[model samples]
Target: MDITIHRPGELTEPLRRAWHRAMDESPEYANPFLAPEFAIGIGRHRAGARVAILREEGEPVGFFPYERDALGVGRAIGLGLSDCQALVHRPGVTWDAQELLRACRLSIFEFDHLVEEQRPFAEHVTGLFASPVIDVKPGDGGYPEWLRGSYPGLAKTTLKKERRLGRDVGEVRFVFDERDPRMLRTLMRWKSAQYRRTGRMDRFARPWIVDVVDHLFHVREEHFTGVLSVLYAGDRPVAAHFGPRSSAVLAAWFTAYDPELRYYSPGLMMHLRTAEAAGRNGVTLVDLGRGDKEYKDWLKTRELRVGEGFAARPHPVAAGYRLWRRPVRGLRNTVLAHPRLRDPADRLLKTVGTLRTSHRADSDGAASGRR
Candidate 1:
C-alpha cells in the first residue's frame, strides 16, 4: 500500500473522479460531507486542510481529509459543522491508522462523527452515539399521501397548523430548492440569533464559516450540491434550511425559523416539508445528525451509530492532546447522555443567554440614545 498527502486543491482531475467513484460505490460514504467537493471547499477556506490519498497498484483507493496545526495536532475537516466524517474508500481498502497518521505527519487525529464502518479506527473509539436518520420514500400520491401513510398522528396536527398559518399570515407555501441569496442571509441571521438565545457558539459570527456557506450555496455538482429550502407564509419567510446533498443523501445541517412565529412550529414544518421534497427529488435518506433533540425523535425512521475519539501515534504531542481534550468531551457527553444532568445544564445556559441578550439590547439602546 502506498500513501501520499496533498493539499485538497492539488488533487488532479483523475483523483477527484476516483474519489467520486469511491463515494458512489459505498452506501455508507454517500454522505455529502465525505464528498471530495466538500473537502475542497473546506480546503479553500482553511489553510491547514490536507488530504491523504491511499493507493495500491498505482490506483487511488482511499481519501482522508483533515486539518493539521504546526504541533501535529489534527482534526477531521469541518469537525464541528460536518455531521458525517470518514476516510472514504473503496471496498476491501484498508490502512494502518498509525501509518496513515505518519504519512500525514500527524500526532493525533480527532473526530466526533466518525462513520461506524471504519474498522481501522475502531479500537481508538471512545464512544458510540446514535445518529438519527430519516429514510425518505416518495409516495405514489405525493407529500400529503406520504405523510398521512407514514405519520398519521403527526400529519393531522401539522396540517392543521399549516392551514392556520395560511389563514393568519397569508398563503403558506414551500420551495424545496430556493435559489434566492437574500433568503440565505436571512437563514444565517436567524441561526445566529438562535445560537445566542441557546447559549451556543454562533457559527455565523465567524467570517470564514459565512464565506464557506456562501461559497457552497453556488456549488452545482453531480456528487454534491447545496440545497436551500424555505417555508413561507403570505410572502413572509417563516422558516428555512440549508444543507448539503450527495446524490442519495441530504444532511440536515443548519435550520432556523422566525422566532416570533414559534407558536406556528415553523421549524418542524420546515423539516417535514424538506423531507417530502427531498424524497420527490430522489434523495433516499435524510441524516438528521448525531444529537438527542426531541425533534430528531419525532422525525427519524431509524438510527445510525457514529463514533467519537482520537486516533494517535505514540508521541508526546499525541498524549498531551488526548489528555487535554478527552476530559472536555467526556464531560459534555455525560451531560448530554443523561437528562438529569442535561436539563439543569440547559436551564443554566438559557439563563446566561437571556442575560447576554438583554445586555446586548441595553447597550444598543444606550448607543442609539447617545446618537
Candidate 2:
C-alpha cells in the first residue's frame, strides 16, 4: 500500500468522486463528517487539516482526514464538533496504524466517536461508548403516521404541546431544511448563550469554527450537505439545528433553542420534527451522537457503539500528550456516566455562570453611570 498526504482542499475532482464512491459502498463511511467537502470546509479555517489517501495498485482506496499541529500531535478533523470519526475506506482495504501515523508525520492521533469497524486502530482504543441514533423508516403512511404508531405516547404529547404552543404563542410550524442565513446567525447566538449558561466552551466564540460553519452552509453535494433545520412559532424562531447530512444519514450537531421557550420543550420538539421531516426527505438515520441525555433515550430507536483513544508511534511527544489528556477525558466520562455526580457538577457550572453574568452586568451598569 502507498499513502499520499495533501491538504483537504487539494483533492481533485477525480479524487472527490472516488471518495464518494467509497462512501456509497459502505454504510459506516456514509457520515457527512467523513466527506471530502467537510474536510475542505475545515481546511479553509484550520491550517493543519490534512487528508491521507491510501492507494493500492495505484488506485485510491481509503481517506484518512486529520489535523496535525507543528508539534506533530494529530487529531481527527473537527474533533470537538464532528460526531463521527473514521478512516473511510472501501472494503478489504487495510493498513497498519503505526505506518499511517508515520505517513501523516504525527506523533499521536487522537480520536473520539470513532466507528467500531476500525480494526487497524482497535488496539489503541481505550473505551467504548453508546451513540444513540434514530432509525428512520418510511411506512405506508410516511414518517408521521409511522412515528405516531411507533411512539404513540410521545407523539401524542409532543403534538399536543405543539398545538398548545401554537395557541399560546402563534402558529407553530416546522421547517426541515431552512436556507436563511439570518436564522443561522440566530442559532449561533442561542447556542453561544446556552454554552455559557452551562459553563461549557462556546464553540462559536472561535473564529475558525465560525468560518467553517459559514463555509459549509454553502456546500451542497451528492454525498454531503450542511443543513440548517428550524422550528418556529409564526415568524419567531424557537429552536434550530445545523448539521451535516449524507444521502442516507444525518449527524445531529449543534442544536439550540430560545431559553424562554424551554417550558414548551422546544428543543425536543425541534428534534422530533427534524427526524420526521428528514425521514420524509430520504434520510434513513439521525445520529443523535454519544451522550446520556434523557431526550436522547426517549427518541432513539437504536444505538451505535463508538470509541475514543489515542494511536501513537512510540514517541515521547505521544506519551506526554496522552498522559496530560487522558486524565481529563476520564474524569469527564466518569461524571457523565453517573447522574449523582453529573447533576452536582451541572449545578456548580450553572452557579458559576450565573455569578459571571451578574458581575458582567454590574460592570456594564457602573460604566454606563460614569459615562
- C-alpha positional error of residue 253 in candidate 1 after TM-score superposition, expressed in Å: 0.1
lDDT of 2 at 141: 85
Query: Over 4 Å off in model 2, which ranges?
Result: 139-146
Q: If scored against the real structure, what TM-score would every candidate get?
A: 0.99, 0.97
The local distance difference test score of each candidate is: 0.95, 0.91
lDDT of 2 by residue, 1-371 (tens): 89999998899999999999999999999989889999999999889999999999999999999999999999999999888999999988878999999999999999998999999999999999999999986566854576697678788878788888999889988888899999999999999988888888889999889989988888888788889999989888999999999999998999999999898999988898888888888999999999999989999999999999999998999999999999999999999999999999999998888887788789999999999
Q: Highest lDDT among the candidates is held by which one?
A: 1
Least accurate 10 contiguous residues by lDDT in model 1: 142-151
Error of 1 at 54 (Å): 0.8
Write down the TM-score for model 2. Answer: 0.97
How far residue 273's Cα lies from its native spot in candidate 2, in Å, is 0.2
Per-residue alpha-carbon lDDT of model 1 for 1-371, expressed as tens digits?
89999999999999999999999999999999999889999999999999999999999999999999999999999989899999999998878998899999999999999999999999999999999999998888967788898788799999899999999998988999999999999999999999999888899999999999998899989899999999999799999999999999999999999999999899999999999999999999999999899989999999999999999999999999999999999999999999999999999888888899999999999999999
Q: How many residue pairs clash in each candidate?
A: 0, 0
